[model samples]
Target chain A: MLQEHAKLITFFSECKELVGRKRLQKMIYILKKCQFPFSERYQFHFYGPYSEELTLRVQELINLGFLQEEKEKKSGYYQYRYTLTGEGEKFLDHYNLDMPNMDEHIEKMSETSSRFLELVSTMLFFEGMPKEEVEEKVLTVKKKQNYTSEELQQAWNFIGDMGIQH
Target chain B: MSYQSEQLREEKVFKDPVHRYVHVRDRVIWDLIGTPEFQRLRRIKQLGTSFYTFHGAEHSRFNHSLGVYEIVRRILENFKEHPDWNEDERLLCLTAGLLHDLGHGPYSHSFEKVFNLDHEDYTREIILGDTSVNRILKRVDPKFPQNVADVIGKTYSNKLVVSIISSQIDADRMDYLQRDAYFTGVSYGHFDMERILRVMRPMDEQVVIKATGMHAVEDYIMSRYQMYWQVYFHPVTRSSEVILTKILHRAKHLYEQNYKFKLAPLHFESFFKEAPTLEDYLKLDESIVMYYFQIWKDEDDEILSDLCNRFVNRHLFKYIEFNPNHQFEQWMELHKLFTEAGINPDYYLEVDSSSDLPYDFYRPGEDEERLPIHLVMKNDELRELSRESDIVEAISGKKRTDHKLYFPSDFIEALSDDSHIKKRILEILEG
Candidate 1:
């Protein structure tokens, strides 16, 4: 169970890096199309929440080692360029996922979490499961059996306090 | 469909000075905030009679509730991005934040003093019992409401989620400190919240600060220390609280004595009867209390009228620094002199002390469950914050206590011009 959960964690971490780097790559593409230093003439606009979200992703990528930024000496505005390291390209190739787009991944994840909780609750209720049985089943369903003693204890403590009585 | 996608028809924004704007994206959070029960928080003062001293502290629990919700929103946003974070805890955290202070009644400090009520227990009841908040949370799932209540009760096993809302330095404290400082206009409460948030890391059992951010944590602790001394324990605020407490005591005493009040205590009936329901609490706010206080200023009962006049008209009792250990005899002597001067010592003379022992280094046998702040090092090893941080160590485990003797200076001045009693009182006050 622990190994499976670790694999899940690895997947999530990699996916996050992929999405972030991909977003950065797209911003670089847009920047390159506009010029070395971005100009208003590039038809690039950040007008809405989606644009704001992409800007946050770009900032994260810059914070990580994936992208490089330079401030224009005259304009005093930041110009971002992708400096794809060996690791970055390898990550991109492993996923076979294209550069980021401001699509619905976050919204999808939220829906997935809500659905996961609902499904678990429904199944437990349907089975007339006892409290421990329900928790055990939920843990198994999530394939989190390989958690550290402290992690398992913490999860159990949370489960007990969450009042997930069947 | 998931509740997150079910946006409000028209986006509702709570104009919170602390959070700037508490944006309601979900219909559930929006509906819950609009409910009459929740709206009543607008009428209830957050700091109770503390406004008498800190005039700028007129903000209500409604403001605080919104601020708490906003902080939780940001924390959950961070958690949602983390791999260890379970996204399922999002709604629970939000619900707990919104409804945490729902059970607070008007003049909460005084009401609790006289009525023996626990607001935390009431918070749970309001969430899990029959209420608008409960109904909205339940709509998400049958157990969703209970999950919220459990979080507020600190019984939820998810330490990370629970700590975000209820721990020593969680969303509740973060909101109240920043919100209280913003309203009271006190510099002492200012801390780099952005820095604190950046340093926050979720561990298995609780949230810990990264070692690099220890200074920020120390700054937060110092801010809390200053707030407690400057705002929370202001002598003028305590004086008003003392007067407010005496007013209730006097009224309750009169009611028990079968004293015929000119205006019947209709609003205080349930309170006098000792069992107030949700409706009773909902009707009791600072406005309603002030309305009754305005009316009570005309009552024939001298004690009641005078107390009401003192509270409403800003005629608070004056106080002097007092040492409980050394000034015990002096305080007792003043109590007798006060009675001789025809002033009730019980109502007029009060010894109020406020103390705070800031963050402590974890000592196992010396202090049980101290929950010392942990800082995760670059090596992924957890270190007790005070061990490596000099600023935190400087003030850790050091307790500071302040005592003050409060009394009516006006009465002393108005006493007979030739009275030596006034001289004695003045001498003690001067000392």
Candidate 2:
């Protein structure tokens, strides 16, 4: 599960720099089906519905240096191509494959620090609850903790600084 | 805690597009914004008919008021940190900035012109008179409200506090420029506001920009210049103002002529008689004007009905560039042709000229007191902006003016087939 989470994060982070959300989602779907070093002709089937916003997002990704685009002359048409760089591949490898834990303290810290673990745990308990229910749960937690207003304000500030969603 | 101390509440915030958020830690500032008098700003358009040109610019004075407050808050924060800034005058500066536009009525410029009502006088009245804003201000200190009024009125001796809210590049102008740009969705009106704030220094008499940030100051001036042309002086906006002025004129004229209307002009009745109280003025906002315009669309007066429909539906008068000096003869000929075509030249045809000197280095004996923007040098010597910067020098003291003649294109198009006057008017318009 740890290896799977890392792989998903690496895949998203790497692809997000190259393509937009919709295209990246489609690319991830295709990769799950056919694996990497994707065929140019095979990807052409997915490029039917392109939008200006998508193009802009793709261009932004290209500017960010995540994906490299190549073009090959084929018959009477130019076949556009794309590939993940060495850096991207290394990121995926580093994140996906598990390693032997040298320090128990660091390993335990990583487990708690993992956003994916936290998200999964929270999702398991409150799978299809309404927003109000989630809010109520948060309020109940606050009440149970008996947090002061200043403490709450500090927590809110920390959350804002960390760019964490409520 | 004492009862009076308990009366004081925690900070309140209004999510504002211009200033991001208007923070009101003081009980007085928060209450002033909530007053019925101040709440009336929400009903008055900030740009006054500029929305007729820039469709997205439908923001009210309420937006600007909050923006002004935010800018003042930021200024006060900077001042509190600096030794040169007076800690005592913090509340005065903030209050003045927040309530600066308190006196403005709906379409203030036109209303003032027609009715001879001075918004500045009304602003003073609202602040010092028996009002909620005054009561809250007096709670701070007895003389506090008067000081705030004096600062806004430009009668205060403390130039430092007054300049923050009223000067050439003060909080008011800074907020409006950015707020207007954001609402209008224009890129030209953006200057590095963050940089400007960082470089602003509180001086003995006035606030001055640090000499190092001259580029930022130049950028601000350029933004103002662009906003003036692109937003403020937009010919379409002027055309709407023209139509609005004509509508008011027609209404006032009809009232004088004893012409009975379907619905009596309740809001405008006092204005027609050339006397309006503070209560009457407060009740008049963009909505009231709009309501009147809607009702006037069905009026028996042809000009009033036509103008009202044009204003409401945004069928604004089309304009062509014309210099009165160069095209005086042509203008007369066009006016004659308009009359021959059964179109009233007085109401339909108008020459509107908009001009502004973007930045002036110095004008020693000028009637309009414009303090030349001074940049504080590294060596602590003050140098005027144009002296050091080439870009600013090139544009400094240069006043640019644009003139355009507005007329109803639909009227000309709908003329009878036998009308040669329409052809003549078209020739003048095209030329």
Candidate 3:
């Protein structure tokens, strides 16, 4: 497999199941910031650090039948979900690739609400800003500017406890 | 122990002059530093020949590397609570930051130019091949070494991870600016890095600054421009660099011509052959290279001996601003005059052109160069920094190039054969 594909497959295997596009992007972004060796360009997009490279990588995996993207109606909106195919399972077993602590991470990531994920991701986006500026902007950057300084502090604590804070 | 067992029982700190203190928490990082290969960096001067111009620039790459790692460490600590921060790959970021410059040989500018070697290639080899660094990394995981190499190589699959080390406003730049300024004792390269860091935000797959921190970012951009022109591209340092290059060239030429030297540059044999293995390259550093230059001062070849003496004793060439295109014929005439005065024009004359695009913020077609610095505006939108800042916008995409003509001033002054050519050459050069 191409090294890029190996990375994608490995990411998927570590995730343990298919995930939503937003969650996957956040996961990949977290991995990259934490220093996983991936080469994709990202920009501040609708959800947060969006990448055209990742969009294409996901498409390529689906086209090759290594992954399946399914849509489900939830609250009158269609939500996209991703999962590995049977062939993807075989290919993964064949390579027997390993990524340390990815399984536990995927489990924790899966349990996170998208809104809370957005909060943490957006708060992080203000890396070197002063506590006040991060607090003020973190609240407004979201669709609803209702987040509190307490929540922001909690988000930081959560990141450290997870052992991922650089 | 398994791969994760590389974590240290306790953190170790290096008291740094630039960053104050550099902390290493992981055993992998500590082991990598302790490796002989990494220690070799201590013997290689960070600024190379710049020390000849700025006496204070005697720091080594090892010092700069630690500074880079410390900057990354702070940035990482700031990142810990970001919802998108991945806890597992924490060590990878630290490792890449620490070992980024591992492959650099002695007097890298001359070594790379004369021998066609890139320190990056050696960085990869050291991180992935049968080296102590690779062993320490592999003990973390077999793929860990390659993964770390890929980050330094700028081919890693994760864009944000790559940016931490290689981006326009990443850890590498943040550290080098302050560290270099501190060592060079120059006022340039000073920016509110703490402010810059404070305003940094992890935007999904890229890092950005808050709009409130725009001024600090602008100061950084301006500082970079000033440092490039003031310190990095200083003519005196370039003159020392030119002399250093000429010394290497003369040695290679004499060796190729079968002139038996009083001291053969055995360490530089592979380099003289223009093909250096990783081991051969690793064995070289500024001290070893300077030792050879010192001994070559009394060599059999007159040109080599003279050039070596000039470089070893800091007798650098003198230079004047000259456009090669405009002064082509005058330059050629001067070269001819030098040859008549019994100086080898090839070894004595050179033109050095240095340029920098102070900042390049997404010029439509050049989006991939670096993800331009972004500022998270209060309106819940992101704007490219140059788009919002007039100072950055003015200099963005504009490359300022400066050219200078260099020659042996002492040779012209020490002219033996009472020739008018020396006077004519000086007139043309001074004119």
Best by DockQ: 3
Instruction: Write model 2 residue lDDT over B127-181, tens digit each, in one string.
Output: 8888888888887778887788768865465667777886657788889889899
Candidate 3's TM-score: 0.71
Q: How many steric overlaps are in each model, in order?
A: 9, 0, 27
DockQ of 3: 0.01
TM-score against truth, every candidate: 0.70, 0.69, 0.71
Q: Write the per-residue lDDT of candidate 3 for residues B360-418, one digit (tens) a residue.
A: 22221121222567789998598878779898888764345566888888888888546
Off by over 4 Å in 3: A1-166, B1-6, B355-369, B416-418
**lDDT of candidate 1 over A1-166, digit per residue (tens):** 0111122222333334332222332332322222222111111111100122233333333343333433222252223223444443443344343333322332332232222323332233223446556455444333423334454454334334433342
**Which candidate number would show the highest TM-score if scored against the true structure?**
3
Better structure of 1 and 3 per DockQ: 3
Extract clashing residue pairs from model 2: none
Tens digit per residue, CA lDDT, model 3, A1-166: 2345557877786665754566666667666665566655454543445554575566556655677877666673445677778776666665555545466655766777655666666656555567677666565444344776677787777567556552
Q: Choose 2 or 3, whichever is better by TM-score.
A: 3
What is each predicted model's overall lDDT from 0 to 1? 0.64, 0.66, 0.74
lDDT of 2 by residue, A22-121 (tens): 3333333333322332211111111111122222223322333434555456564333345555644554454345432223322322333222222222
User: In model 1, which regions exceed 4 Å deviation?
Assistant: A1-166, B2-5, B9-11, B355-366
